[model samples]
Target: MSKYIQAIGIWFLIIPLAIINGGLRENILIKLGDIALLLSGIILSICIFVVAYLLIPKIKNCKQTDYFIFGIIWFILTNLFDLFMYISEGGGIKDLLGSYNFLTGNLWILVVITTFISPIVVSKIKKRKGEIKNV
Candidate 1:
């Protein structure tokens, strides 16, 4: 698929996640207390999405395995960065990490899946188009 289509897919994943998370934040966390982290979470999630999506695809042969490995690496890397931030800043926004859901964390994982699937799907389309052109 084209980048436009990929972006649409990303938006599809982001929107529902935004709704669910917004609800959870208002109903559970905000009602309880600790909304100081709200702005940071929004910023972080978007930043992570933008940075990872741009950075990951450019790397050569970034397969499903590559995406998965990169995801795990980024997960660890974020935690490590958080560790440093926590140490330096007397606990920054990253310290409140568990406040969000992970099962479908803003559909970031979906990007990883797309990384795996997009090449296969796009390549097949390309091949079919080439055949049609030849015929």
Candidate 2:
């Protein structure tokens, strides 16, 4: 539907910003090491989820389902972008896939989980607040 399309559009806008943030984090990580990288990634994931939560409500006719769809689209597109960048930079498919190794390179998984759950969490928070206000 149109709402889903709009969600995709919004995601397109978000993707570039995320890539820039990721690049900056990667640079910082090289200097500060894994702990700093992991901590920064966790913090960034929280911030991204919060932003998505706040923005989702503003889309006209958006429902919980739409947010899920948006998350899915965003995730797929980001992975594709990563894949493209890897290949373009002369990296192999194995390396591209290995980047997902949870034991080593799992920070992205946090982002994935946050993206999927953010809408639901935001909806619940809003509902709880509404209930509290009414009572």
Candidate 3:
């Protein structure tokens, strides 16, 4: 579905940003093996979210609100995890977290935040076509 496409698109955008940061420090995660792990995470996360949506079967009409919360949590946690991962790989957590230009970090941040948010956004399109649950 279009949602899956959108999800993959978001990953393509974010993964590059992560790779840039990861590679800037010569972090090993930017290499082929780690790249595979990263891709797998993104693809799997997307599939899980889609399946959750399909199986839940009864979302509240407050769809945007639900997704906003999910996106915020996901964004914060994803960044934090990345922060720590880079730290463990020999980069200073504070440096990586604090040294970036706001503009640059914001791109990756937005990519991450919106990856989770896209589901809610895409669902609105389907909801308009009456793909909604009343339960």
For TM-score, the strongest prediction is 2
Give each prediction's root-mean-square deviation over alpha carbons.
Answer: 10.4, 3.9, 9.5
Q: How would you encode candidate 3's per-residue C-alpha lDDT over 1-135 as one tens digit per residue?
A: 343333333434444544555454345433555344444444444544554355322444434555555455556556675777778878776755553434432233344545556556556655676876322
The window of 10 residues in a row where model 2 has the poorest summed lDDT is 126-135
Off by over 4 Å in 1: 1-34, 89-135
Decoy 3 TM-score against native: 0.44
- What's the number of clashes in each of the models? 0, 0, 0
- The residue-by-residue lDDT of candidate 2 on 36-126, one tens digit each, is 5576557657776767666655566545565667777767766776688888989866776776676784576777667666755665576
Identify the leading candidate in terms of lDDT. Answer: 2
Q: In model 2, what is the error at residue 95, expressed in angstroms?
A: 2.7
Q: For candidate 1, lDDT tens digit of each residue in 1-135?
A: 444344334434444544565566666656645542444355446644654444334344334444444444444444554466566868765553532343423333343344334434433444456421211
Q: What clash count does candidate 3 reach?
A: 0
